[model samples]
Target: MQSRREFLQSCLATPLLLNNFRYSDEKIITVLGEVTTSQLGPALIHEHILVDFIGADKISSNRWEHSQVISKVLPYLTEIKNRGIKTLVECTPAYIGRDVLLLEKISKQSGIHIITNTGYYGASDNKYLPPWAFRETPVQLARRWISESVNGIEGSKIRPGFIKIGVNPGPLSPMHQKLVKAAALTHLETGLTICSHTGPAIPAFEQIELLEKEGVHPGAFVWVHANSSDTNNFIKAAKMGAWISLDGISDDSLLKNAEIIHLLKTENLLNKVLISHDAGWYKPGEENGGEFRGFTTISDKLLPLLKTKGFTNADLDQLMLKNPVQMLSVRVRKT
Candidate 1:
């Protein structure tokens, strides 16, 4: 009998299995409108424009002005645009300061394709979840998300490009499971990719398993914040056709992130990986948005480190360009 690693390798080698993870002709939804994958160019799969840590009941768009946020955050978007980043996925979910109008304004001013999401964030002990999230069934929650995808978010014509949900970092709690199921239902109807803010392998795999049980293929899910999980777990999850998002790239983690990417390349799993700084945002209620981090580390720091580690231009493209386009392109990936 084949060992687990051997079985995974064989499965990845299968043409049909691999094709399921490739980019399709489908267009990705942007804050402005739909764009082809080729138009996506070099992309950051995970990042934020604004985030409010206040509990859901208290969070409101009234706390921050769109003009002030655009003034504070547009320079960072321009910085990445200068570095050849054409697209940015704003992963901040609803009830935590996800203003689609704000994202649309930033995208228009900066000339960068910004993609926003639809869903609830259940991480941080469910503090970001609205009160109704606890009372609503998965189907009910999914209807809300689907409505946004079809009719546009918050009464505007700006539709979500993906489904962004969050779960705590342990085994799936009942509430978190409901969030995952709702995401699944939304994806089935809207074909939006699910980007869950999951750290560590336990919850990541649990979410993946839950997605599979819902008849959503693993390719439909992105294991966000996957840098927190073991490298071995990355191999396992990548073999299952999930996108491994090592999105917390920073100056402090240059070497470690480079090594991890190198290992994934060696395992022939680099195509399944997504990289970003997980940086940015104008924090609500903080003076001057508090110490905002620019989204330049991957372009300025990590890419240089990766090149020193013998990464080719094509390898870099696979991580920054191809992988993201394939992973984020709109498709209903069902098993």
Candidate 2:
């Protein structure tokens, strides 16, 4: 088995092959040509581009609505750029209104790296509207995602940086199994990292264990929102070799709070952790709270608190910069 260091390095390395395959006679570059994080200049590990519906099937509109551009969201991103923010990861799953064009706008406007996902959401949040539940087998799912990584989503050139999954707070359901099987398949194909959303209770190691069994290398997968759990569980996941996302927040979800930043630094988990407000660019309720529900604390709060706590440039660099880059550099494979 490849060690975490080796795995990350493999994922991060960019290879240039297919010299004969060209766009307009220029050699085409595959996902293996560049690590997602490598293509990303500066990035927040998580963010929402444009989310219309949680359940894709419920929407009476077109499937492509999810793929529509982020042109309307450019102005909201202006503040983030003004605050020196750049790059983002959109965790929206298929059919659930994951808008790439909106992200494109944010990318161009804020000059940020916007990395998106290629897997399913939590069991309760199946926005894919697959017309039926659990349609594809694990092997088949893996093959398709691998095809996307190389050829791009839907045969376009828009590749995803990671494979996202979620262990919702409830017991394992059949739908969950399908997702797990699919994720394992994705791991087999693209070797992209798995970013999981742990539910309200901070799921048990069993879920993580199941993933490892399904072929997801621990080093390549992450359990986002693990900070909601106590220190013991947080450290447990760390020891198990999964990266822990530490954007821990109160109900308010204020950004980079002084207390949380201090807690992270004190525990020495900085190197293995990532930080973000999971900021929502949209107004909650279609313009009231700005689209995102409870993460109000992210926008103007987190970074300033870190600074107030005397987190110097180097400190921020490690938490927000070096750590994620280092982690990505590990499982990264480039052709």
Candidate 3:
């Protein structure tokens, strides 16, 4: 029987598999352009530069000015950059203030490689979804997203690094299921990993199952907000080849997050784990874009806690560096 590490190594090393699945290139799409995984250093797999909660109907780029948002948000990116963070996966999707041009400018100014996405967020009771999301078939939606992958989003010539979707905390709703299927279809065509804002195990497993039913591998699905699920589920999902994203790290959740990491390490599933602050954003309509959270908790708080828990520098690198390259690298993982 093959061990998990051996299985992962085989998958990553097989030249024929890489050619077939388009993994030989091993590139990560950023707002600026494609970059080799080696170019992506210690990364925060999930973070936001700006997010506007205004519904899809009313959300527009005009809601916030670029200069004002940059002035307010750049310092946070600079903070993380100074802390040795190289990449920030901006999780704010379209219709919710995902300005690729703005991300380009920020990446250039902050010297942090920024990645944007191309998917409709169906969470928040579907408030962020546009009307077409409800009316279009999954295939149609997939076509639109695949076009963005090939052609670039909103004519910006900036492609997405992954597929971002959302579902309510419960079992997948019919609409959310459509979003999952669309994400699966998009992944099959474009090789973009699916990062769903799922909070609980029920929806997380449902999304994984749905992706598998579409012939997409669980490796291509990232269970975002996996910290909200039970630890046993993290073990189960990681064993099943899903990336467990415990992205809600904060000062208050430090001990809890550290305990979870320790448990996963004991289970020998650390290779499947991803950690981040899920922090940031200059909120639109609020005074100065609201109380913006800096992206430094993992650097200043979580790493030190993990060390106290007997985590070595290698374990820390696995969580912050190696796992991110494996997770975020563009590959068509098929079952």
Candidate 4:
């Protein structure tokens, strides 16, 4: 229930650590339904723990599915935990197979701080559906998102810890803008953070501005999919206040890999950046992004690259953990 500033101030009370700020036991705080101790471990800001499709008459993946899913996702999430990853923000929302119960189950099974999302994605994602397909007044939609994010989704125990918005691959549509405003209002009301599904395009920054129209704070919003964006654009976004999620680390493109590495070194925006694979994209009966690709990127690639680049232990911790914890505190909750 603490505000964003309160969380950051509390975290800063602890002395800075060699690798990052060491969480002091005395300053730990509980959030949403989970407890965040000052133990200070690695955190992934953008990734999907569960992703299934919903429909007009379909219930989609729900808690009942948790029993089945845990057996599958537990192994992958466990590997992340094994790599010393302690916390992860699940950016999936209502439309993108955002199942709170399933995420909670994953957290319980994996013993990681799994932060789930609330609110709907961009209209392009669900504009095809009727009823919801028809556009409603901003207030009406905002009310629904606020309720879903704060309260449970349809009386379920899965409350969203953040509000999520998105920008299509091109310019922001009027629908995306409306959704952004609603997302921002939902966050202002609930103190939850806002995460977005921005592509490797320019709209992420534009989306941030639209959210700004509602006075959304930049620190609390994380613009995703920047790992493939233009180099300077990535830095520009970091300068704007929202955390830049370099989450597409799995694409296996050496040019992108090298570009990201260079940006990490030159920008020195480690505290405002994040890393994730955005994996586990299980579309109803489809496995587009799921796999047992060991934590090669986090465990082997990035760290080794950092060491080779002469990033001190402190620098590694900042890029790996501290920066994320700091950004997590910037946005108030959407739920």
Q: Which candidate wins on lDDT?
A: 3
What's the TM-score of every candidate structure? 0.92, 0.74, 0.92, 0.81
Model 3 clash pairs are none
lDDT comparing candidate 4 with the true structure? 0.64
Candidate 1, lDDT over the whole model: 0.88
- The full ranking of all candidates by lDDT, starting with the best, is 3, 1, 4, 2
Model 2 has an lDDT value of: 0.57
lDDT of 2 by residue, 126-213 (tens): 5453644467666666676678777777545677777877666766666776676677667666667777777343354656667777
After superposing candidate 3, which stretches have Cα over 4 Å from the reference?
A: 1-24
Cα RMSD for candidate 2? 10.4
How does each model score on lDDT?
0.88, 0.57, 0.89, 0.64
Error of 2 at 237 (Å): 0.8
For model 2, where is the 10-residue window of minimal lDDT?
Answer: 21-30
Q: For every model in order, what is the number of clashing pairs? A: 0, 37, 0, 6
Residue-by-residue lDDT tens digits, candidate 1, 155-195: 99999999999999899999999999999999999899999
- Those runs of model 2 whose alpha carbons end farther than 4 Å from true positions after fitting are 1-41, 60-71, 125-129, 200-204, 248-251, 254-258, 281-300, 307-310, 327-335
Cα error, candidate 4, residue 45 (Å)? 1.8
Ten contiguous residues minimizing lDDT sum, candidate 4:
23-32
TM-score, candidate 2, is: 0.74
Candidate 3 accuracy as lDDT: 0.89
Over 1-335, each residue of candidate 3 has an lDDT whose tens digit, in order, gives: 98755644443232211111222359999999999977888899999989998888898898889999999988888888777789999999998889999999999999999999988889889999989999999999999999999999998799999999999999899999999999999999998999999999999999999999999999999999998989999999999999999999999999999999999999999999999988897899999899988998888777766766787667777887788888888889999
